[model samples]
Target: MLNLDVVWTSEFAANKWIMPLPADAIPTDKMIPATVNAATYRDTLVGAPYYTDGALFYFRSDLLKAAGIAARPKTWDEMKTACKAILALPAAAGMSCYAGQFDKNEALTVNFSEAVASAGGTVVDAEGKPTVNTPEAKKGLNLLVDGFKQGFFPSDAITYLEEQGRRAFQDGKLVFLRNWPFLHASLSATDGSSKVAGKFGITSIPGTDGPGVSTLGGRNLAISPFTANKATALEFIKFFTSEEQAKKRLALSSRAPAYASLYADPAVVAKRPFFPTLLTSLNNAQPRPKVVQYGATTKAIQEEAYAAITGKKDTDTALNDMQAKLTELSAK
Candidate 1:
């Protein structure tokens, strides 16, 4: 959008694009750093971040308590062990161990990126180099592919996106779910649609060695360059990203605010008890490979990762294929 002249840019603290922002527009000292970095392209400010999002682990606390599990798993290996114990219980009969967004689309790209990143591998480097064939990459890929082959995740999870995975967990079909923050409010609501309300808990996604890296996901507000009223656009942007609106977003929908101080506010913290954990997630999350050809790059990722997960291609073959294809797209 920046390259095509599709949007009007803003100067905000989180601006980091190659396009420069207006001087002395907005001080971004209160916004989260990772979000700012993600919006920045070549040191220019082009967008005002609205909400920041990252992957979170949701699980049945009651199931863990019954399985004699002492706490949430800190690592993927530990989570695997916990899944095994929990699945053995009679109450957990017909239940799958875990679920995530793995359908062959953009969600799969995010899921695959997190797996590789959690194992300390990069799909593509800052210089647009594909790096998906290393030992760390293999370790990460196997965690999901191997798990699928061994029945850790249901074979049907090969078709789940956010809604499908959310429904599976909400219907009490899965023990653990990996999703973005928006699901918290929906699942925790007092309404009758939620079957697991108040029966679950949230935590960081488990990593190979410890906490995993989350693929940053959120929205940034930008005005179109063709807008007739630039001043009005600026005012709207200002009001939308203000601290007051940030608090409103959080309180109304469990939406993570772009401002950092809101995470520490007594009222905000009391309403969203997991703000600290969310802050940590945002701090550690990495944006998707910052390429202009994002659609092509992510399609390359989804194809190979989906093939690997569904047994159509081996992990070694899938990663090798993905690296070659991404390298080709990056060069263009």
Candidate 2:
């Protein structure tokens, strides 16, 4: 819709697109600055955030306690060390250390972005310059590559998407799972289907040095630029982003609200006790590369990253190949 010029972008999308947006349509002061920043482009807002998503570190609290682990892992190294300890126990024989989306798909793109950002690198700068071959990015990508090689991550994870990894965690086959906020509700359902319910805890995704950055995901409301009902459209956008609606959603669903205040709302807090952790994750989140040909760029990264994870390409070779592919995509 943005490329086709059909939709009327909100201040959030306008900001993301680096173009001018109507001032009056900007999100209200109640919105979170980090979330507002995520939707803004080039200092202009073009979308109204509805819900926000970010990667959170989920762990089997029961398993961690049983293994005598004292606290959550704060870095990738710590997580791996903890995993090593957990796997050594007689009861955790069949479980793996960690899991995330490693499949050659768009989900892989998100995972790759988080890995790179955690190491303090960006795939593309604001000017659209490719930076996939940088040392920081290499360090980030190496974490994933090395994990697969050393068996810190399951060999079968190359085919796992969100649901696949979620199921693995839900089935109690994984010690840690890197995923979005929705997993909390699914795992905590009152139904008897979930084995990890009330047995897990959520925290910030383990970072390279500390807490890892997350790839931002969520829905934003935008209007059609060509729409005849601009007035009605803007009204709906305003309504959707209203504090009331946001609070309602926070109370009803696991969807994280765009309003900062909702994170502290007593009603919301009562239902989602992990809102504080999720908020921190969102604050550290970064969006995927903002390019018109994002799909192609993601595909290239996926192909190269998956190969590296699967040991088809060494780290340097994979980084070099990814840089070349991304550079080509940016030029178009």
Candidate 3:
């Protein structure tokens, strides 16, 4: 039986449960721990990275070839043109990538933040202030709205979850898709659930200025300062993060390791062909703002910014309100 209740650190800052983790057992980077963001870097090395994953662009190769383009776009402008060209085809239904309805709350914020990075922007200004209202963010949102208006983006995406959008691509309607690395297991499953498996190509989300970009936050295992099993927890971290054990854990679970090494395995590379491209993207990846209030700020952007783009609200009014909201949020 499980020793004690396991709650996401995001939900509870200090959890008390079970003994320390086993020597070879890996920690959950995305889910485990309590406030590793504030705990890991400042207080101590509370958790070590296991395997990690992030946003990867997946597309339909057959469609690209038919469109007279054989290579994946290495630039955002090219990506936009590719989207438009694909949308113009007789098979055009809509683009079903992460550009979905902006639902899935936290994930969407992470998604939007990633978009900002791709455009060579960031969530906070250099002085440690939120920059969601900056011109780059505006440019990024305008691109989303442009697609939404052109019918390349779905009207229902605002309501769809990541998995919901993932399954939708199987409808054979989407020309492209974006998701975390976990799809390697699901997409290749022989369960007969996916229609486009073995049919789509994967790449990085081409960057607007340089190449492409991916957000970087891997699952980490951290013991709550309140945990009674500190020894066991430390032991577990050592084992799980071990180069040997990480490879095994990754084979068994969807969670990725945080190390920069395990990515070199032939098996890992073969399965995730876009791995190399994603690594390059990772080099330029930026972490989310360190503030605890990041979660709330992102929510405001989704509900407000996405609404404006989806036609639920006017851009000028929505953006003005966003600026006011950020200003108010910062003052507090």
Worst 10-residue stretch by lDDT in candidate 3?
1-10
Could you give the C-alpha RMSD of every candidate to the true structure, in order shown?
Answer: 3.8, 3.2, 5.4
Q: Each candidate: what lDDT?
A: 0.80, 0.80, 0.59
Residue 284, model 3, lDDT: 56
Scored by TM-score, the top model is 2
After best superposition, candidate 1 residue 207: deviation in angstroms? 0.5
lDDT of 3: 0.59
* Candidate 1: segments with Cα more than 4 A from true spot: 1-19, 190-192, 223-232
Per-residue lDDT of model 2, residues 1-332, tens digit only? 23221112232243343233467775557776666765666666666777778888899888789888998998999998898889999879899999899999988888988999999999989766789899999998998998888898888898999999989999889999998888887899769878889899999998789999988887666655666776787777777778888877765677788787777778778888999888888877877777657667778989999988888999899999999998988787
Angstrom error at residue 213, model 3: 2.4
Estimate candidate 2's alpha-carbon lDDT, on a 0 to 1 scale: 0.80
lDDT of 1 at 74: 75
Task: At residue 152, give the lDDT of candidate 1.
Answer: 83
Weakest ten-residue segment in model 2 by summed lDDT: 3-12
Query: Candidate 1 residues 219-327, lDDT tens each?
Result: 7765555567766876777787787888877656766877888888998878777788888888899887776677778889999998999889999999999989988
